[model samples]
Target: MTLPSYFLDNPYNVEGTEVVGNKLSPENELIEYFVQFRNDDLLDTLNTFEFNLEINENLILQKTLMENKDSFRNILRDAITMGTILLNFDRDDMVNINLQGKRLRNNIKINLEVPSNITLKELTASDYEGDVVTFEAKVSYWSKKRTITHMADYKCPDCGDIITRPFKSKIKDRCVEDKVFYEFFKPNISEDTRRITLREISDDFSEGKLPVSISADVYGKTVWEIELSDKVIVTGVFRSIPLRMENGKISQEFIPTIQVISVQNMKTDKMELPDMELMKKFQDLEAEGKLVEAVIDGFAYNIYKKRNEKKAILCSLIGSIWIGQVGKGNPPMIHILFVGDPDTFKSTIMKYVINVSDNCVLADSTTVSNAGIKAIAIKSDDGRWSIRAGLLPEYHGGVVFLDEFGDLKSDIYADLKAPMIDGWVSKHVAGEDFNGRAETGILASMNPTDGVYDDSKSILENLSVLKKPLITRFDLITKFSIDFNNAYDTQIGEHFDKCDFEGKPESFLKDEEIKLFINYVKTIT
Candidate 1:
């Protein structure tokens, strides 16, 4: 196949006729220079272009290659396009190349300053006009694919001229000589699409703020690789789509949309401890039979004196942390419910767990629904079903603190019974089925109906909302009450008087140390 004139540094215009004294574009110049001066290098580059990486000091590609980065990039891009032409690879534009070609490539990545990964808060509306950027986010929801024009091939009957025009580009559409309508127009389109909603996530939950999400359109080769809840690092151009008015007029408002260029699945396949030195320390503690105590000291550093509750939470945390290790059949998922009186540290303990948890979700029972706690497929305005997985399935391997568990709706109890009893959530909505392993542990809490525990009432009677069958799902049931004990009251009084509540005590273990240990346990698991 003959290469297009524009594909080389030829002075041939759109008319396929040679033009004299026209200034060559950077790509044209680079291509001509490469083929003439560095034919071997150019050919080698074309062959191994897919494996190219960041212009680093390697034995083959020298440091001088990065000198004229823009020019070199132009050459590489030209070579890649030529390779595409040779291999009959599908590509839309420079922004959207065959991602399979960029598997381990570094040259294209150098175009954008990555780790330029800004949070949704920092990525302002005004920043849409900027260059390519990177965002590390979780794929929250993915919509169905739709076809779009990649390019159009047109030919003129009279002049016998043909020209290829990319979609949304100002390239030669009709024959340059005829300047007439095409004799034949064949629009090349692709249905390779993965439209996803990316939500801003932080382990701290950003102190309980509304999550900022952006709708991203993944195309080309990376579409099929992405899945729901997959943590991905995306590098793309931020293109704002004009919102249409109800009256069909284009509104002034624009939608936040990203035309994804590359999607690097950053999901951790295995938990790994960062500190090797700390592993030895943990081993020493374990050998001395003080590991559990150390973990408790670290985990309950902020608390005054709630040993039983702390140990219970710790046990559940350990179980949730290592739950992924279990193979075959169902895992022994640990669920805990802390029923307590009002004006106690129930919420405090939940908050502490939230702070410590890496993949934990804190749900106020008043605001939660079956949709929010589990996966449910809902039909959108377009009549297409889209799966919206709740916090439980979304944070599958993690734990969820269902605060104010007493206030949980009665219907939610029946819905959760199956998932709790058998570690799985099956939701079939309007012919849409979503069955996933619900391995998430629920660290839930409840307060008494009268704001004080009554000795006259049974556990189920105190919280009328909590049914017996649903309550049985929990392996541990701990009670938080102000018992009128002399020694307990003295300890509480002493803690209230002496504890500064300023900085963490020197004797207390740090959260990182505990996290490292847990991660270490996961490595072994």
Candidate 2:
């Protein structure tokens, strides 16, 4: 059965209250629960039902509904209907009916807020089957929002009576025309339903685990407002779809899906800025016109050579952000490509900036793909298409460090043109149009071919792998060479010796102070 929405439902089970035995049906049980617990929310604009596993442990414990999520959600829907009907019992038709022809209960959405669910550790331990669980994940993809009819406003063709039947009970495709995407898609989702793709955070992938990705058929205004890369807590009932065979027929194989109950963005994960004292300290630096110099000093202090390269990167760091995008004269963020020989400390240099900078993602060519850097179209077992954002949109307002940039795939190199030149990119993939705004800075590093930097060759010749058009997008190119001059080598040797001799090399700022200063500058800049 294809169910993408819990659309306009019939008012049911409002015979005062069901006075059955202790083993109350799920719908009656929820009504009793709402009356006793969530009564205030029932009358509120957003009809949210907050269910805490820790608090409402007893709600489904005796009834055994928690084990079967489909049945649980089905009953919850019915409960919402019965509760809405209960409100009409006291509502005066003349007074409650507003100019918009909407009752107070017209937009009463049943948002089920589950505070706890399966975790990464728990997922490895046992199979969840089809349990209704909650978990936090990053939104990777979204189908463009389309309007869908919640309830039929037109009359039945056979009988001129106003058709107020439950959307499901009505003959499929007779009144409500829903396009089939394996699962049905009504798509009139302006107020109600939307489809989004959620993937487990990158931490799971770093553990050499296949990060889980699932399609969520979400119902509500809240989840639809979430943008790409927004970390969200989603509550949904798991289900399996029959996998399609190569011959375009349904096979015995099954793939999992989630019918989302409700979703909320995980707001607490945002970076917490430092206290007033540190913030004010940077403000004072700006006031004294020494903020830029102070930020440069806070950068890599122990690295011996590449003084000019350091300044170039500092230009990228400050200039990339401070350079406004508002005015016509304003330029996009500065992009820098560092090509050098081995032991030139390119990795060390980029890592320092990556560590100091907020929202920095390191994508090495050895691992990432073209689609991984930009957006890609993903198709689920059911024939639905969604566009998943790549590294650029994930760290949209921030910078990305592309390591081992020379070894990057040729196709991926060609893909970098649109983004580096223009601040936006569009991919017309799988019959879906995906456009993303990436006001992001690029600071990429590469070791020259054969582990040696050739100063005699032109800038483009030294880096033969990257295309000319793509290379031109970079605002600055810094080349690092290993100078074997006796004086320079002795100085480098002395710096290394000092590191081994003393506990550590001297720095202009402490580790904690450096982080505070960088983040502080990022904000004001």
Global lDDT of each candidate: 0.61, 0.61
Residue range with the least summed lDDT across 10 consecutive positions in model 2: 1-10
lDDT of 1 by residue, 343-427 (tens): 6787778667765557677777644663355665645433456677666667777777887777777766777777765567777
Where in model 1 is the C-alpha error above 4 Å?
1-81, 84-113, 152-191, 203-208, 245-248, 272-274, 320-330, 376-386, 428-437, 485-487, 501-503
Off-target runs (Cα >4 Å) in candidate 2 are: 1-15, 19-68, 71-125, 142-195, 203-212, 238-240, 244-252, 268-270, 277-328, 352-354, 366-373, 381-384, 409-414, 448-451, 464-469, 486-513
- Clash pairs detected, candidate 1: 52-106, 53-106, 54-106
Please tell me which predicted candidate would have the highest TM-score against the true structure: 1
Q: Give the lDDT of residue 222 in candidate 1.
A: 58
Prediction 2 TM-score vs. true: 0.71
Among all windows of 10 consecutive residues in model 1, the one with the lowest summed lDDT is 104-113
- Whole-structure CA lDDT of model 2: 0.61
